[model samples]
Target chain A: MFLAFVAATLVITYFSARKSSGASAYFAAGRRITGWQNGLAVAGDYMSAASFLGIAGMIAMNGYDGFMYSVGFLVAYLTVLYIVAEPLRNSGKYTMADMLAYRLSPKPVRAAASLSTLTVSVFYMIAQMVGAGVLVRQLIPGVSYEVAVVGVGLLMVVYVVFGGMLATTWVQIIKAILLMSGSIFLSVLVLREYHFDLGEFFTRLTAIESTAPDGTKVVRNFLTPGLIFKNPWDQISLGMALLFGTAGLPHILIRFYTVPDAKTARSSVVWAMAIIGLFYIMTTFFGFGAASLMGPDYVQANGGTNMAAPELARKLGGEVFFAFISAVAFATILAVVAGLTISASTSFAHDFFTNVIHHGKEHQPGQEVLVARIAAFVVGALAIVIAIILGPGVNVAFLVGLAFAVAASANLPVMLFSIFWKRFNTNGAVVGLLVGLTSSILLILISPDFMGENAIFPLKNPALLSIPIGFLAAIIGTLLSKEVPSEDKFVEFQVRANTGLGSEKATEH
Target chain B: MNDPQPSAADKPPIDWHRIQRDPDFSALVRSKARLVIPATVFFIVYYFALPIGVGWFPEFMEKKIWGDMNIAYFFALSQFLMAWVLAAIYVVAASGWDRSERTLLAKFGYTSKH
Candidate 1:
């Protein structure tokens, strides 16, 4: 099943490679993707292995606290639809930095934005890479963690380097369909176990019996809150990060550029919200099914938390169902990493290399695409090496959470201020990005996740403090700087953003 | 990829100041802001209420409305519905904005291909 998925995706890459040529085609898929197509790709890019396997496992183990992650993930899209999507599609050409560089000083703003983009992407990519390794090893015996990591990494590199965004988008769309189908089937089987009785399902969930760490059997209600998150502040902070993070995600933002116009972008966001919202709601059935039917203790003893969904499949539908679910998980990881690699490489080539280093000019035609391909290879290799070094024991969930924190704090504030605030200048953009990036990392280092009992920060997620600091830095930096704000450029940007008067159009075939 | 013309050169010179000063453009912006700002604030407040309610008033939130379905679990499930409804409303509202945008562009002598 896994090999069949791999072969299907490679065939997609072959066709995409034949069609991809110029910078526009390679980067934005010729801006020809329909609303629903881009919507599926966006959902595919957004839902990672962490979301699929990790969230289900979390709910299976921690109950209500795990479901909190789902609420925040879907709500985060409103921020995207209302504020980020249309303006970004109208104003920017390639990457998130393109939007910022539209109104601010190109070199400084592009450099700062590119750094944040790479930081968020690398953090996100490493988590997915580590997850791929751990998951593949468990699903298929005789596969080492290091070997799995390298294989996934190389495959992503091949997708980005040869087929570019077109292949990556299709891979994600296909993965999304498979994931939704798998989840639906699993949810159905779980419901069938209870004869589709909601009362019985909820009754079982309320009293989940498990063995304690001290060898005592305990019965806990999975419906109650505070299972995993002890502190209210930690819960609120995580809520803030996830509530605002999706808007700032580089890979998610770049998908807006795949469509023809702002209206399509608008419709695509609606489609994504529908698909994503439904998928998250179904987690209740499968997650609680794992806890109520198989029991958390059994799941933990079998293969730990991340295997909750697959274990439930094995229990209810036998080995064949388990294998199919495992392959879907593998596809999930590959699609997410491919999306991340393209966004990172696009930022590096477009913002850092072509715009920042070469002063917004490519030395030759097709040079930007060439540079992006090289960057994709380098980024993939780096992720593989780091995942191998860190090994599978490192917490993949923490890294993904940190990526959201960085995005919410660093990328979001800067991008928002650039579009809405006329006084926002190069200094503000630079300061906002640097301060947000550094503060989130610093707070995480001192938090309980890293420092154990000696932790200074009480909250596990840093967005509660760091996001406010990011917005403040932008405001203060803009006020303190002596540079004069250019009204003409701001007016131009507003017109384009509002009416799509001079935005990039879809390329003709 | 087929076209040799760079993307930048294809765009005609736009009278940004004129569009910015137009009353129709202002109305369009005002209409969007009226819906988006309040809708955003409402959803954010509604979303945060879950964690706050669960954390601060666990006993109250734990009260079962229907067979083991506590307020906490029920509220979390409602968020998915809230998001979908809000998105549908936004999409519906945006169609009006699209019409206004088209009229504004037409006044400026540019016809949108889409």
Candidate 2:
């Protein structure tokens, strides 16, 4: 089944590659994805291994605190659905740069956005690659760590280079299907153990006692929520980060450009919300179900809590079910990695090279596409090498938080301003991006993860502080800077963004 | 006027300010904001309540409503239902906006492709 999936996707890539020769097709899938298609693509692209293995494991280990992450993630999409979706589709061409370029100066805005986009994608990709390396090695025996990392990296590069958005979309769609069905099967199987009685299932689950890592007999109540964040304030801050951060995610935002117009974009977000929301609710089942069936001892003893879902499958239906879910997780990682690679490469080639280096004057569509393909290879190689060197020992949790924080602080504020606030000039965008990026990174670097003994920062996530700074910096910089981008330009941008008048040309693909 | 597009040299002049005055365009914007802004604020508040409740009132959240299932877990599941219902409502609301947009486009001598 795993090899068949890989083969089918490769075949899809082959066909899409031939059709994806145009500049629009290369970067934006010719803006042809229907509402339902784009919706599936969005959910597929967005739900990573973290949601699949990490959160389920979190619930297995810590209980309700782990489930909170899923809630935050699902809720964040409302921001995307309501605020960002329409304006983004109406204005953007290829990258987020296209949206900002509407009002801000193309050179500086694209330059800053390119840097931010690459930063988020690189950190996110490295984390996934490292996790992929560790997980794949364990799941598929005899596959060395280096081999796992390299295999995933190369496959990701190939997907982006050949299929671009078209192939990547299908890969994600397929992954979404496999993951949802697998989770549903797992949930149903778990429920079956209690004769399909949710109440009985919960009663027995909480009644059971499990062993913890410290070799203590523990009775874990998967019902209550406090294992992760003891402090209410910290919980609020983490919630703020996730809620705002999702809108700024580079890979997620880029998918909006794949649809034709604002209408499709809006509808797609609704579709994504339904799919993602339902899947997450089932994940709550997966998490609680794992703890109930396999117990925390099994989860931890095998390989921390990351093994919860797979272990649960093994317990319920033996090896075949375990292998099936493992394959689905593998596909999940691959789809996310490919999605990240394409977005990062698009930023590097289209935004950085074609726009910034060539000052938006280059008309070489073929050259840009070639550059993007090369960029994908380089990005994949770098991520693989770094993941191998890091060897899964790096503190990826901190980096994920940092990625979301940086995105929320840097990207979200500027995007909101660019679309809504008329006075948002180029200086504000550049300053806001720099401030948000640096502050988030600096805080994380000093936090307990990096500084350890001498860490000064109190919180694990920095959105509570840095997000305000991002918004304030943009406002203050716009007021302070003497550079006023032309009024006529702002008017043109406003009209275009509002009315979808002079956005990218649509093809009848 | 029938072109519906700008040829390279002879681009159609769009009176953006006039469109701002056009009832169809303004109505579209107003209706969208009226629905979206309120929905967003409502969801954010409703969503944030769960985390805060779970964080501060763990004991209360742990209070079992049926069997051993706590109030918190049930509340979280309700969010799933709420999200789906909101999406369904938005589809209906968006269809109306979409219709207005189509009429406005046609009135402006543009084709609604679908």
Give the best candidate by TM-score: 1
Docking class of 1: medium
lDDT of 1 at A133: 88
Query: Candidate 1: which stretches are off by over 4 Å?
Result: A394-398, B1-12
Best candidate according to lDDT = 1
lDDT of 2: 0.80
As a whole number from 0 to 100, the lDDT of residue A407 in candidate 1 is 96
State the lDDT of candidate 1 residue by residue for A1-509, as single tens digits: 98899999999999999988898899999999999999999999988877878788888886888889889999999999999999999888888888888877888888888889988998899989988887788888999989989999999899999999999999999999999999999999999999999999999888888888898988999999998888888888999999888899999999999999999999999888888988888888888899998888987886677778888999999999999998998899999999999999999998899887887778999899999999999988988888898787654655777799999999999998988898898899999999999998899989988899999998899999999999998888888898866899899889889988778888888
Chain B, TM-score, each prediction? 0.90, 0.85
Off by over 4 Å in 2: A207-214, A363-365, A393-399, B1-10, B112-114
Model 2, A245-364: lDDT tens digits are: 999999999998888788788888888888888788877678888877777777777756566787888888788888888888888889999999999899888888988887665576
Query: What are the RMSDs of all candidates, in order?
Result: 2.2, 2.9
Error of 1 at A12 (Å): 0.4
lDDT of 2 at B27: 81
- The candidate 2 chain A region of ten consecutive residues with least summed lDDT is A392-401
